[model samples]
Target: MTGHVTKPGRALRRLLAPLAAHAILIAATAVMLLPLAWMVSTSLKQSGIGLSRGIEWLPWRDAWTNGKETVDVMVLGARVAPGDGGEAVEVGIKSLASRRRFTTVYVPEGAFEAEIEAWRIRPLTGEDETAEARWAPFASVRRRVAPEWGNYREALEKMRFWVCLANTLAITFLGTAGTILSCSLVAYGFARFRFPGNNVLFLVLLSSMMLPSVVTMIPVYLLFRELHWIDTLLPLFAPAWFSVNAFAVFLFRQYYMTLPFDLDDAAQIDGCSALGTYWRVLLPLSRPVMATVGIFCFTHYWLDFMGPLIYLNTSEKFTLALGLYTFKGAYTTQWHYLMAATLAVSLPCIVLFFAGQRFFVRGVVMSGLKA
Candidate 1:
């Protein structure tokens, strides 16, 4: 009787468990995506002005520069006292058109001039028309918002953005290709071949992953310098060709090991060599893992800052990661341009990851199942 009553409770828990998990996942995703959404918002925003004011979740249709302005001018025909005015106070034509309000003007700080006098504007029909001038800023300002699409154009124009983009793409493509080819070959050897001390060698490779990259930084830099690879992209992508990434090789090896060894034996029985077996029999089945590794390698190379900073010397050869530094200076930061350039740089990676997401998930799951 108790078991029958418990069955319904178990069923209810099973039904609610997935829903609760999904709700938590949705909240986590939103938290992760908030910064990215804000970055996109800032990319579309106008410029450096008003950034310190507050947070803006959404980009405005147009950013308008609206504020009180004070300007220096010569106040002419001023009355000495109330009801004793011999001549009315006059404002110069220069002051009337002092602002470039015809177009949306962004005055970060008010105007500076060689000469200025605070002049008050009085209504013609007011009782104080004949009174002495009182200094105050007027509200005869026209405010408007114009489309800030120029932020993109300005960001591009400010730096060699196209060059950085091209360099990044070239490096990413070469690094991904090299990593796939080399790591897959290494993974195949580790998964299939039987050699003396093979397991020991593989253990050493995995242990290397525990060493911090900083330990090898100086030696790697000196080696590259000796090879005259510094200041060139060779320092960035050449390492990928050596299967130096233990984690990627480990992932590929695990995935490869999950396949039945019967396929290799069958290929050998058909007079196919070891290399032939890997190419014809195993490579075709490895697409999912290949995609996962490619995606990881692409993103790593694309967003890699420290490597590019250490190796690259010239501005023309800079990657997008290094190009961002141009937007920041000793005293000022161009938040809009920085965000815009960042968005432009990251868009390709974002698209690639989303497009290959299914393959990536399948590869990770299959790889982990075996190892």
Candidate 2:
């Protein structure tokens, strides 16, 4: 009698549960996207003057320089390995000295001494060379001062923003594609194949998922440098070929593990090879999981700043994140322009996540079910 009485109430909840869940999801989405909204708002705000005083959301100047003025040179250093073409060496008068211009020049990785030598060797007429010596390392250099807008404009014009964008997009597309193909194949093998030490090997792969990136970065960098890939995008995209992202493989494996054994048996009976069975049958049914994996890979690589920062040495190879970092001076930052560039770079990823959220959720839930 009690069970019968409770059944109607349970039915009512089943009818209402989806609506309630949707409401909660809407609230969560709002919370998640609010920061993004604010970022966009800040990016469009106008640059105002007197930055020292405060920020205003209108185009203006901030204490424009009166005339040629001298600024001190400050150097930041990091130790590098010998024979890496990076060591302090002597130049006659000017030393690379880490940085020359307070605003634009930051020699993150290079021999400061060699930089000084390179600059010193450049031809200068009598008075011009005297002026060059005045601006030389270990001396105060004066130059015509202007507004920060010049820096922003120079960066916009000189920096390979479009080239970097292309490189980044290529890396994102190719890397994600390779990761999906390789991880899916290896994952399906692990899910269905019977072989020696398979369980132990899967465990080892799972353990690798817990390893931090910092542990592998230097060794990977050294390996790439030896391969002559240090300054290229190949280093960025090549790892996906081998299924190095253990987490993605694990995700796909978990999803594949739930597939009915009967399906593979039927394929075998139909004269299908193992790879043929997977390509023809399993892939069509794995859309949700594939979308989930694609979204994850896309988001991870799209926002990657560190890898490109370390490997790309030239301005032409700058990713959006590294390019944005240039808006900031050592002592001050152009907050307005920085914020603008930040929002510009983040919008595409935001659009992608929202478009794929439905598949992401469904894949996550269904993949966890044990058959």
Candidate 3:
């Protein structure tokens, strides 16, 4: 009886453990996604109302319907006024200070408009300057979800998004290809060949990763200037071809070391040269590492802002990251448009990660296993 009771208790505890863990993971995911949700919400909202005091998850706006047409409006205030019959409800764009002075149009006491007359407010156009005050009944106005989908269209147009996207794509593709080719070659040498000072040379290469890019920024800029590569995409992607990414080389080398040396011998027996063996046998087998490095390089080149800012001068040469900066003026920013553009710019990276997630995880796990 005691053993059976304890077995059920243990089973219950096992079930609850995964449940608790899943609950925690779900909560954490929601927390991490909050900022992205807010960005989407802001992107859909009307310009002036997006940053309201209250937290609104949906894009809502105040809308009013006149007799012929309906239009969005801002509510001002309401007041009592002398009607033809007697004192009745009055609502208008007139301010409280000037309410008594402005001419009022009173609605009948029994009218539906009179029931909501107290809720009326000023239109977005501001105080009525006309001799007669302009107002709408509160019953005619309502809070409705009206997302400004046009913000994205307007943002793309203003930011020259297509041109910037093209430039970013060019740089990302070229740079990712260069990183993979160059880093793999270096990593192959370190993994396969026997040479004097090989370990020391690799240590020196790895040490470069510890040095901050800020230390070399000025010197690199001067070198690019000397080469007349300033204001061009060459400065952005050319260095990638030289296997400058030590971490990438390290990942490749580790993954290569996991492969058997017999493969190299087999390739040699089949009349394949060292370079040919790497190209056919080793590289073709390194899909996981390649995917991992490609995604990393793609993300880096796609979002690189400082490189483009320092090297490229013309607007046409701007990457998406730098192009987004154009939305902020010296005085004020268009927050809705900025949010829309940001969401648009971030979608590709998000999609790419999800698409290559399996390979990325496998690459990271397998790379460290042997080394």
Candidate 4:
């Protein structure tokens, strides 16, 4: 009955379904990307731009259009000039009333259409009158891109950026390595070894994920303090070595179970010990899951704020997340520099995810299907 629809109806459904899906996806993508784009925009803008009404999507635009800079504009207000039709007068442009719209050019003779083409903008360096060009009035707009690369430099100056960046990279590498190795080991044991209380222990481990990090944060801090590990990266890196992450263990366990037990048996028959089997047989085959776990651990370590803030007192030991807070002061906040620093910090994660996205997704899907 359903297949008995008209050809036009069927075609319409096929067309509409994909269109709707794409529309929704595009909207979701825009929702995510707009803020990042805006951050880039804000970071590139020259500082001291207070809270404005409209959004500045692009950082660089001409003075007349974006109302950002002042230029000597020649307006064509009741003028019978010699050569062409454009006003050439130097006026200090200021966007006072409307930030979203164009600058209010105070025309000396009160011209109505005070637009770009009607006005001959002065050269930025005030050398030559290059405004009288091949432009036939009201033509294509010439856009000038002024990328403020200095924002990144200034942002680095706001905090101990190099030190923090180095610390973050070190912690991320060590932490991810430890997480993958420890989790894989624990997961192999749980997946292969038929030990007593294995199921109960697994259940307990899974349940640990439900508990908030805030619940255990103080106790862990106190323990680390007693061990004199305060203000050290050890406080962050030590736990990964012990496979304290329940979700990572669970993910690894699920992935490991997906592998054929026959492989292990075959390895054992070849005089390979359990450790040998894990090292040679399983480890080689578990690249996807390893990548997944590594990505997770890397992301967590990179974005960790509370952990670093609580443990590290000295600015020298601060992570990127901790160092970023320095941009905020009692009276003012450096939004441009903050955004620039954030973009710089987020770049590594973005690159890593894009590079290993396929592996990460496949690992997740395969783990779910098997267990």
Candidate 5:
């Protein structure tokens, strides 16, 4: 009887364990995703309203009806004052500056026409020296969800997004290709060839990874400047051709070592040279590692800011990462436009990661496991 009762309790605990773990994981995921959610929310919000006092998850705007037509308005403030018709309510129409009202209107107490004061501007005419301000009662004002989808369009235009995007894509594709080819060749040699000082050379290469990039930054800049590569994209993608990334080479070499030696022997028996064997047999079989390395290289090159900032002097040659910096001026930063452009720029990386996630995980796992 005790065994039977305990078995049921054990089964219940087993079920609850996974449930509790999943609940915790879901909560952690939500926490991690909160900033991204806020970015999306702020990107859609109207300007000047994004920094509201409270957390607003949705893009909401105030609309006011003046009994004739409804129009969007900015609510300044409200106050109560004495009037001929009972207690009167005073609402400010427009705000010219802090603690100052551009226009004011009076409304009777308990009147549906006057709850709060709000202001909207009319299109300026040639006869008008300034924009015409229209005021309405607070009772006619209603908060509604109105996402400013045009923020993306305006932001893109301001950032010269297409030009930056083209430059970024060019650098990313070229650099990614170079990294894969150069790293794979070097890794293959390290994995398959047996020569004196091979391990020592690889150790030296690995040790280079520990060195701070700042140590080489000035020397590299001088070298590129001498080569007349300054103010050009050459400095950005050119280093990939030399297999500068020790991590990518290490990944490829590990994956290569996991493959059987018999495959190399069979390829040799079939009259395939070392290069042919690598291109035909090993390279084809390294899809997972290739996808992993390609994604890493793509992201690095796509979002490289310091590289572009140092080498590319002209706005026409700017990458998306550097172009986003223009949204911040000496005085004010356009947070809405910045967030919108940031979200737009980050979409490709997010999509690429999700699409190649399976291969990326497989590559990392398989690279770690020895045959």
Candidate 6:
């Protein structure tokens, strides 16, 4: 009876240990999520104080009393051009009265441009222009109070968003698929076969991994130009098929090395060829490593701004990273629109990461066990 009671007590302790570990993990997870929460809070904040509408210009006050000089509002990027086009303009206001700055206020892109242009053409307007023109001083003061939702709409509409998104997806999918296939095959060869000069060849492949990415970028560009692959997705996807991912190959090789050789031997004994054995036996058990490789490939291509910027000359082929650049001006940037676009663009990556969270955790844990 005492032994039975002690056995149950031991089992309870084991269960409690994992429960305690999970509680600590939950706390760490919350800590990791704080910055993202703050970014979201700022994105949704209104532009001014006591605005009835849910949305306000920028979230904070304008102007600062640092007293160096009355700082003019600096527009980060304009969402829309003012006029009949009706795009929204992103505005930054520095209010001398409030002594703070407003970062992401929306004004009608058309309205902002029209306001500035109207000021430029003010002398030419006849007295009969309108009742508003007759009361120009009051109009000027009231101009700052209007909401500018059209600017946001206009900016969102102009940027071929769907097209850019499609291009990005195509590149990422093809790149990841090709890289995994080629890297896995090459890795299988290195792990299983004892060919002549195998060590030397692998050493060469490993050495290329140490080369700076910048050093080869120009050459890659030139080669792509010669092959007429630039400005298209071909240059982006084709490299992976040709075994460009040395690190991936190395990773796959390490994983394959730990696979039981008896399985390969058994397959051979059953009259299976090398390719058949690999395909039939080894691949079936390779899900963890494949998932690991997939995650890496997805992230690398998804966040690759420089590659798309250099190769994709047309707006139609632009990735999200390239499209985001449109919000920037020579002297200003539309922070509101930029922030909105940034949050929007980041959504896909976040979704993918969470969706694959289980596989990612499992694969990474299992992969290290072997290597």
The model with the greatest TM-score is 5
**What is each predicted model's overall lDDT from 0 to 1?**
0.70, 0.63, 0.79, 0.71, 0.78, 0.66
Selected candidate, larger lDDT, 2 vs 3: 3
- Residue 5 CA error for candidate 3 (Å)? 9.8
Candidate 3 lDDT (Cα, whole model)?
Answer: 0.79
The lDDT, on a scale of 0 to 1, for candidate 2 is 0.63
> Judged by TM-score relative to the true structure, which candidate is superior, 3 or 5?
5
At residue 313, candidate 4 shows an lDDT of 89
Query: How many backbone clashes does every candidate have?
Result: 2, 5, 5, 3, 2, 27
Candidate 3 Cα errors over 4 Å, as ranges: 1-23, 72-138, 362-371
Better of 1 and 6 by lDDT: 1
- Give lDDT tens digits, candidate 4, residues 1-58: 6667687798899989999999999999999998888888877765543213146555
**Candidate 2 wrongly placed segments (more than 4 Å):** 1-38, 50-159, 327-332, 360-371
Model 6, residue 333: what's the lDDT?
42
Q: RMSD to native for every prediction?
A: 9.1, 17.5, 7.0, 8.5, 7.1, 13.7
| Alpha-carbon runs more than 4 Å astray in model 1 | 1-31, 48-53, 61-147, 361-371
Query: Arrange candidates by lDDT, highest first: which order?
Result: 3, 5, 4, 1, 6, 2
List candidate 6 segments past 4 Å from native: 1-35, 45-156, 329-332, 358-371
lDDT of 1 by residue, 298-326 (tens): 88999999999899999888998888765
Minimum summed lDDT over a 10-residue window in model 1 is located at 105-114
Local accuracy of candidate 6 as per-residue lDDT tens digits, 129-246? 4433433331222223223344345445555567777888888899999998899889999999999999999999888988899998998899999999888888888898988998
Residues 1-371, candidate 3: write the lDDT tens digits: 99988998999999999999999999999999999999999888766534552578888766656667666654444456777557666645322233332333454444524234234223333323441233344444566777889989988888889999999999999999999999999999999999998999999988897899999999999999999999889999999999999989998998899999999999999999999999999999998889899988988999898999899889898889988876555214577888889988988999998999887676567556734
Count backbone overlaps in model 1: 2
Model 4 TM-score is 0.73
In model 4, which runs have C-alpha deviations exceeding 4 angstroms? 1-17, 50-53, 61-143, 330-332, 362-371
